[model samples]
Target: MARTYSLNTEAAKEANNGGKRINETGKYSGKIIAAFYEKNQKGTESVNIMFVSESGQECGPLNLYTHNSSGEELAGYKMLNALMACAKVQGLTWQDTPIDLYDYDEQKVVTKTKECAVELQGKRIGLVLQQEEYQKNNGDIGQRMVIAAPFEADTELMAVEILSRISQPQALGNYMAFIAKNPVRRLKNSQASQPAPRQAENPDPYDDDIPF
Candidate 1:
């Protein structure tokens, strides 16, 4: 059976993510379930991505795009590039293709389409999840685990400590070793600064009360 893909153009579910927050902040091995490019009416371009562990769980349909610029590239593109680099080092190749985006709201078969690095679908990669705060409708600080970094999936996922510098993932080409120097701060979401040892081998394994 083919996996169903939703563009999720609606404002993300904000109330405990509509009670679907089953993951926590930590590292997880997964694949790029989907990637797409979109330009809004404001003429802002974005690359949206989704991730999941084939064995269990899912995250995102998160937009990796931002107006935060650094030199010739946007920070979001660098994150996407790092994901691509991770997969490429694992022998995944790429090509341009179209993605069928479904509109599940109106009982529709298909309501939208877009071209992207379609070849990236299902490519293995690693994600470093970090919790961030968002204001709830009740003015409470809600937490969500976000993809903070992408590393090569083929490496020992347990030993993945140092996420590469935005300028370095393509060069280091592996998860075990890093660029070994100061990180170039290109984006607010990711800076090559290493993470502390994971409290669990796998972060949230889906409890009924998962924060994110």
Candidate 2:
């Protein structure tokens, strides 16, 4: 049976935005599960081959007409190719097993995905997969897979350490530091940046004597 795909407005928006970012260097790791093709419906042209995320979470039906490039239209297949390449590099294979999509809501999936992304990001020192975008593709692909690590500093260092334990270490300390500094700044900025006050809180006078 074909998998059902569903997404609320937010997921659809994010997926659509991610799809628009695909470029020649294959910098965009997000996949397009569906494509648009011309079909006659009620004597008018209509969309065909709508891609959907396997989990049916935030993703909505993706129309193919939105894609501007033939290569971009092949996003799903390209992501699969990248995943297979990564597996091969790590001496892994998918001969008899089926691939499973990572569920962002699940703790195990979250940990595994973060770990993989962090390692690759650390090694590369200059790439970051839009994580929500990655999640959408994860659902679309419906398989256990991996990608090159993201370039976010903390993720980079974590990834480097993990990969090093399994293989050889490289000099990414500078890159890691560069990535780390900005996040720290952002954290501080976020703390300092507060929204303006709204109405004052209403105190519950009747509960003043309640037990702690």
Which candidate leads the pack in lDDT? 1
**Which parts of model 1 have CA positions greater than 4 angstroms off?**
1-22, 66-72, 89-111, 135-142, 156-212
* Candidate 2: Cα lDDT at 208: 38
Which residue pairs collide in model 1, if any?
23-212
* Count of steric clashes across candidates, in order: 1, 16
Query: Model 2, 95: alpha-carbon shift in Å?
Result: 3.7
Predictions in order: lDDT: 0.52, 0.27
Candidate closest to the true structure, highest TM-score: 1
Candidate 2: residue 210 lDDT (0-100): 19
Model 1 TM: 0.51
